[model samples]
Target: MAEFYHSVTLIEEKCVGCTNCIKRCPTEAIRIRGGKAVIASERCIDCGECIRICPHHAKRARHTHLSRLSDFTYKIALPAPALYGQFNNLDDIDYVLNGLKQMGFDDVFEVSRAAELVSEATRKLMVSGKIKRPVISSACPAVVRLIRVRFPDLCDHVLPLKSPMETAAAMAKQEAAERTGLPPEQIGCFFLTPCPAKVTDIKMPLGIEKSQVDGAIAISEVFPELSQKMDHLETVETIANSGVIGVSWATSGGESAALLNEKYLAADGIENVIRVLEEIEDERIGELEFIELNACAGGCVGGVLCVENPYVAKARIQRLRKYLPVSQNHLMGGPIPELMGWEAGLEFSNALTLSADLKQAMQMMVDIDSMEEELPGLDCGACGAPTCRAFAEDVIRGGCEKTDCIFIYRKQMQKVADTISKLDGLKQFSKEEKKD
Candidate 1:
C-alpha cells in the first residue's frame, strides 16, 4: 500500500456513522466502518467536503496553531487573498496584513501579490504554446490532487506551476532572509490558509519533492486574534500591494479572468469541477484555451476553514477589489523562471487500482461485477461504503460481507422464514396423514 498523509481526519467519538460525508466525497475516500468514519488516505485530497457536510462537526482539518510561530527565529505570515474577505466592512487589505503582524507575525506577505505574478507567468506560458490546451489551473491544491488521482488523462494539461501560496512562501523567505540577515532555515514562512487542502499540500506536496511553506494555519483559527488586532489598531500600515487581478482570486472565475482571455472556462464546486473535467477528458470542451477549477463553491472564500459565509465573503472580495489597481506584479520580459514552475511533472496515482497484479486485478473485477449484480444498485450509502458498487468491491476484497447490505440481509431473513413455514406445513400434512 502506498503511504498516505492527510490533514483531514475523523473524530471517532463524534462520528455517528452518518452517511452524509461518504456521499458528498468526490473521491469516495470516506467510509463508515465499525460505526465510525474511516478515511482512505491515498484517495483523500483533503478537499474538506466531509468537513463541511458532517453535522456533528466530526471531521476537521489539522493545522499549525499560532504557538508554532514561537519555534522560528523570524516568523512571516503569507496570508491568502481569501483572508481579506473574512473581515466585515473592510475597505483596505492593509488592515488585515497589519493585524496579522500585530497578532505575532514579524512580517506579513500577501499571497495575492504572488498570485499576480503567477497570473502573468500563466499568460506568458499560454502565449508560448508549449503546453496542452485547455490548460487547467494548478492553483487549487485540492483540484490538482483530484486531477492526479481521478483525471489522469488531464494530467499533462495541468499547468506546471507551483501554487501562489508556495510561490509566496518562497518569496517571503528570500526577502526575510535578506532583510533580517537570517538563515533560510530560521525564517518560517507560514500560510494563513483558507482550506485544509493547502494544509495537506504543505505536508505532502503534489508536483514538488518538498514544500516551501513551513506551516499552514487556518483562516478561521486566525480570525479571532486578527479581528481583535484590527479592531484595536490606531493606524493601518501601507502593506497592501497587489490589486484587483490578484485579490479577485479569492472568488470564482478570478484566475481565468486574470488571464485576460475570453476563450477560457472556469468552474467552481467539486461536483461541477468533476463534470468539467469529464467533458475535457472526453475532448468535448475544445473552444477554450484555459480552464480554472476550484473545489469550493465560491472559490477560496468557500473553503471550510473560512469564518464568513462563502457568498458574503465573495461579495466582500468584490467590494475589496473595486479600489485596487488592475494588477501590481508582473514578470520581466523573458522566459518563465524555473523557480515559478513545478519541480516535477504530474503523474497518475494507482491508488484507485483494483490490484497490482494484472491477473489478480482481472479476477477481482469479475468478482466485483458478480457481487454488484447481487446488490440492489442503490448508491444510498447505507452499507457504509459510498455506493453499491463500492460495497460490492468491499465484499470482493474481504473487507465486508454481503449481508452488510440491509437489502441483502432482509432478503436472507425472508428466505429463512419461508423455509421454516414450508417445513412446518410439511410436518402438519404428515401428522394429518398419519391420523387418517
Candidate 2:
C-alpha cells in the first residue's frame, strides 16, 4: 500500500475529544478514541476543515516556514492570488509582491499569472470537442482528493490540467535557471499558500508524478512580517503582471467567469462542492459546459491558514481588480503545453470501500446494511463515528465494537441488570420454600 501524507495534525494535549471536528468533516475520516480525536490517514484529504472547526486549536497544519528559505541559494516566492486579499485596503498588488522581495526572496512570481494562462488554456480546451462535458475544475487539491475517494464515477469529468500553483512553480524555476544559471535544485520556488491542502499536494501530488514546488509556506505564517514590510517599503516595484481575470480567481465563480462561458456553474465550501459533484454524478446538469468547485468557503481567501475574514477579503479583491486589465497572460498559440496538462489521470481510492473483491464487497455491503439497521440512526456522533452507518462499518471492519454506541451500551447494561434481578428473585423464592 502507498503511504499518505496529510498536512493536518492533531496536538493531543489540546484536544478535548469534542465532536465538532468529527461532525463537520466532509469525509467521515475522524473518530474519538481514548478520549482524544483520531484521524484515519487514508481518508483524510488535508482539507483543513477540522483545523477550522476545532475549538481548542488542537488541529494544525504542517507547513514550510520562512527559515527553510536558507536551504536554497535563490528563493522565489509564488504568491497565490488569495494573498492579494489579505491586506487592509490593499490598493496595489505590487505592495504585496515587493513586500515578498523585501523578505529575502530573490524574486517573486504571481500564481495568478499562471492562473491567467490556465484560464486561456481551459477556454481553448473547451472549444475543442475532446474533453467530457461539464469539465470539473482541478484547481483545488482538497476537492480533487474528495472526488478521488468519494465520487469515483466522476473522475473522468475532471479537467486534465495542472493547478496554477504547479504551473507557477515550474515557470519560476525555469526563469530563475535561465536568469541566474542556478540549478533547479538550488533555486527553490515556494508557494505562499492559503490552505493546507496545497501543502499536502506538494508532498503527494495528483495528476503529476512529483510536484515542482519546493515547499509551501502558510499565508498566516508570512502575513505578519509581510504586512510590516509592506508598511515600511520605501519603494514599491511594478512587479505585478496579472490582470483582472487572474486576480479574480481569489474567490468562487472567478474561474468560471474567466472561461467566458455562461454555461458554467461555480460552487464554494466543501458541502456545496459535494452537492455539485453529486449533481454531476447523477447527470442532472448535463447542459453545463464547466463546473468550478472550491473546497474553502468564499474560495481560497477563506482557507483556514489565511488570517483575513473571507467576505472582507473577497471585497478587497474586487476593489483591487478595478485598475487591472481583463487579462495579461495569454497562450502563445499552439497545442496546450504538455507541462500544463496532467500526466496521469485521477484514480479512484478504495480507502472508503469495504472490500476490493466483488463478491466479498457485496457480502460486506449486506453486513453493513444489517448492522446499520440495528443502530439508532441518530448520527449524533456519540460513538466517535460521524454517523450510525459509519459506526456500523467501523464495527464490521474491527476498528470498533457495536457496544461502542451509547444506545447499544445502555441496552446491554439494562439486559444484564434485568438478568441479575431475576436471579436474585428466584434465589429468595427458593430459600423461602426451603424454610417452609
Candidate 3:
C-alpha cells in the first residue's frame, strides 16, 4: 500500500554526491547511491528539513497548487499563522488577507481564529486538571510523528485538540457553506501550509478519524504572487475578530502566551523539541500542564517550505503582534471555543502501519542489529545508506545487497584475495599464461 505522503524524495539529476541530506535527516531516511540521493519512506517523518537545505532545490514538498481550487464553486483560504511571517513589512493584516484574494482565493480565514479556539481549548484542558501534567501541543505534525516513532511512551501527554489547521478548516467549511448556501463539497478550504508534514497530516490525520481540510497550497509556491499583490494593496490590520493571543500562535512561546500561563513552556526546532520531549518523557519537567513544540525554529515562520529568511520573518511577526487585540481577560469570556469539546483520547497503535507484516519487520530488525554491530560507527554515508542499520534494512527490503555494507564488502574482498592465493599454489595454467 502506498503511504499517504512520501515527504522526502530524490531528484537524481540534481544530486552532486554531497551527502549533506543523508547526514542531516533526523530519522536517517536518506541515502546516497550512484552519486544520487534516495529516500526511505518508513523512516521519514516529513519534517521538510531536507527540502530547505538542498541547494539544488531537488527536494520538493507535495502540495496542491492554487489551480486545483478551480474545482470548487467557492474557495476559501485558511492561512496558517506562520504564513503571516512570510513577507517583510506585512504589518497590515488586511494587505496579507487581500494578497490571498489577489492570488485567486475567494475568501481568507485566519488560522488564528482556530488559534483562538485552540487557546480556549488549551486553557480549559489545563484548568480541568483531567490530563497528565505537561500536555504536549499537537499543532506540529512533525512533532506528533516524532512522538509516535521515537517517544512513543510520551504519547499520553499530548493534548488532543485537532491542529489549528484542522480547526480552521472545519470552521471555514462549515461557516462558508452555511452562510453562502453552498454544499460542503462545493466549498474548498485550502490551507497555506509551511511544511510537507501538514500536507501528510491533512491526508492522514493522527489521533483523529478524519481531517476537515480540503487541500493545501505550499507557502513557497504562492509567496511570489503574494509579494507582487502586496505592492498595490492598502494596509488593513484586523484585530477585533481574533486578537494578539491568537496571532501569537505562529512563533515559539506563542502558545504559552495564548494560554497566558507562565508555568508552561514552549520549544521549537526539531532537535531542540526532541530533546525537551525526551526530558519530559523522563519526568524532568514535572508539574507542568502545557508543552508547546514546533518542529521549525521560530515556529511555523521558519518552516522549510517558506520563502523569506526565518530570522527576518520572526522580527516582522513580533511587530504584527502589537496590533492584535486578544487579551487574557477577553479570551476568558464565556463560551470560549476551547469549551466546545475539542479534546480527543490519544492511543498509539503498536502495529506499524507502514509495514505489511510483523514478520518482515522483525527479520529486518535482526539483520539491522547484526550489521550495526559490525559497522565503523562513523555514519559517513560512503556506503550509500544513512546508517549501517539503514543499509541492513535496505538489504532486507531488496533495495540494496549485503555488499553495500562497506565492512561486509571488505570481508568478501579479503576472502577473494585468500582464494586467489590458494589457487596460485595449485595453478598449472598460471605459469603457462604468464609465459604466453
Candidate 4:
C-alpha cells in the first residue's frame, strides 16, 4: 500500500484512546490500536471530524505557516469568506483584508470573488441541462472524497467545475504574474482555509493536474494576528470585488440560494450530505437541478479550524449579507470561457475497491458475509472496528482475527472446555471397564 499525504494528523502522545473520534468519523476511518487512535489514510476524507470530537486535541491540521510567505517574491492571500465570521463586532471586512497585508502578504484576493464566478457558472450549467440530475457541488473536497470512497455510483453527478479556492488561486497567480511582470513561479497564492480538507485539497487537488495555490494556512493560525491588527488599524483598504452572493457561500444553503432557483438543495454536515447522496443514488432526488454539500455543519463556519460557534458565525454572516448590495447580474458572467466544460481529467479515487480481481473480491465478500453471521452484531469498537460487518472485513483483509472478538473467543473457549470434559468422561469409563 502506497502512503498518501493527509492534512489531518494525530499527535500520538496526546491521544487518550477515547472513542469520541471513532463514533464521530463519518467514514469510520479511525480505529483504536495499541491505546492510540490510528487514522486509515486511504479511508480518511480529511473532514476534521476527529479534530473536533477529540477531547485531548490530539488531532491537528497540517498547513503552511506564515513564515513560508518569505520564500516567495510576491505573496497573494486568498481569504475564504468564512474568515469574516471569526471575529466579534466586525462591521467592515476591509480590516480583515488589510490585516493580511500586515501579516506579510503582498496582495489579498477574496475567494468569495471566485465563488461568484463559480455560482454563475453553475447556474449556466444548470440551465443548459447537460449535467445529470442533482448535480453535486465540487466545492467541498471532503464531500467529493466521500463520494469517491463510499458512493462511486454517484461520482458522475459531481459537478466538474473547480472549487472557488482553486479558481481564485489560478486567477490570482495569472493576474499577479501579468501585473508584476514576474514569472508565475515567483508569485505565491496561499489560501486562508477554514478546514483541514481544503488544506489537503491544495496539497493533493482533485480534477486539476496541479494546484495553482502554493500552500494553505489555517484561519485559526492567523486569527489572533488578524484580530489584533483589525482592532488598532486606523485605515483599511476596500474589499470591493465580492458581492453578497459570493460572501454568502460560507454558510449552508448559500450556494443553492445564490442560484435563484427553487429546485436546488443544500446539505451541510457530512452525515446529512451522506444521506442526501444516498437519496441521489436511489434516484429519489432526480427532480433537483443542483445540490450543494458541505462537510462541516453550518457550512464552513462549523469547520474544525474555526474559532467562533457555528450558529453565531452563521448569524454574523447573515447580518453581513444584509448589508451588501444584492444584484441580479451574474458575477464574472459565469466562469472563464476556458474553464466552462466538464473536468474530463478527474476520476474517482476508488479507495473502497476491495481487490483488483473480481472473482477474488466476490469470494472475500462471501467470506465477510459468513464471518458477520458468527459475530455478536454488537457493532462495538472493542475489536478496533466500528461495526461487526467492518470487523469481518478486517478479518478478511488479515487485519484482525476472529479470536480478537471477545464473544467469538468466549465461544471457542467453551467449545474447548466441552471437548476436554468429554475426553475425561471417556477415560473414566474405560478405566471402570478395566476394573470390572
- Identify the leading candidate in terms of lDDT: 2
Superior by TM-score: candidate 1 or candidate 4: 1
List TM-scores for all candidates, in order.
0.96, 0.98, 0.86, 0.95
TM-score for candidate 2: 0.98
Q: Residue-wise lDDT of candidate 2 within 25-75, one digit each (tens)?
A: 888999999989999999999889999889899999999999999999999
Name the better of 1 and 3 by TM-score: 1
lDDT of 4 at 29: 87
Q: CA lDDT of each candidate? A: 0.92, 0.94, 0.78, 0.86
Give residue 194's lDDT in candidate 4 (0 to 100).
Answer: 91
Residue-level lDDT tens digits of model 3 in 46-67:
8888887888878877888888
Residue 311 of model 4, lDDT score: 91
How much is 279 displaced in model 3, in angstroms? 1.8
Q: Evaluate residue 200 in candidate 4 and report its C-alpha lDDT on the 0 to 100 scale.
A: 88
Over 4 Å off, model 4: 1-3, 327-336, 339-345, 429-436
- Select the stronger candidate by lDDT from 2 and 4: 2
User: Which scores better on TM-score, 2 or 3?
Assistant: 2
Give the higher-lDDT candidate: 2 or 3.
2
Error of 2 at 271 (Å): 0.8
Residue 347 of candidate 2: its Cα lDDT? 96
Clashes of each: 0, 0, 7, 0
lDDT of 4 by residue, 1-436 (tens): 2357899999999998876788788887888888888999989999998888888999999999989998899999999989998877666778889888888888999998888888888888878877777888888999999988898888888888888888888888888888999999899999988999998888787887678889899898999998887777778778557778888999989888988899889999988998999999999997788899999999999898888899999999988877677633354543446653335644666566778899999999999999999999988778877788888998998987889888999999999999999999999999999999
True-vs-predicted CA distance for residue 205, candidate 3, Å: 1.6
Q: What is the lDDT of candidate 1?
A: 0.92
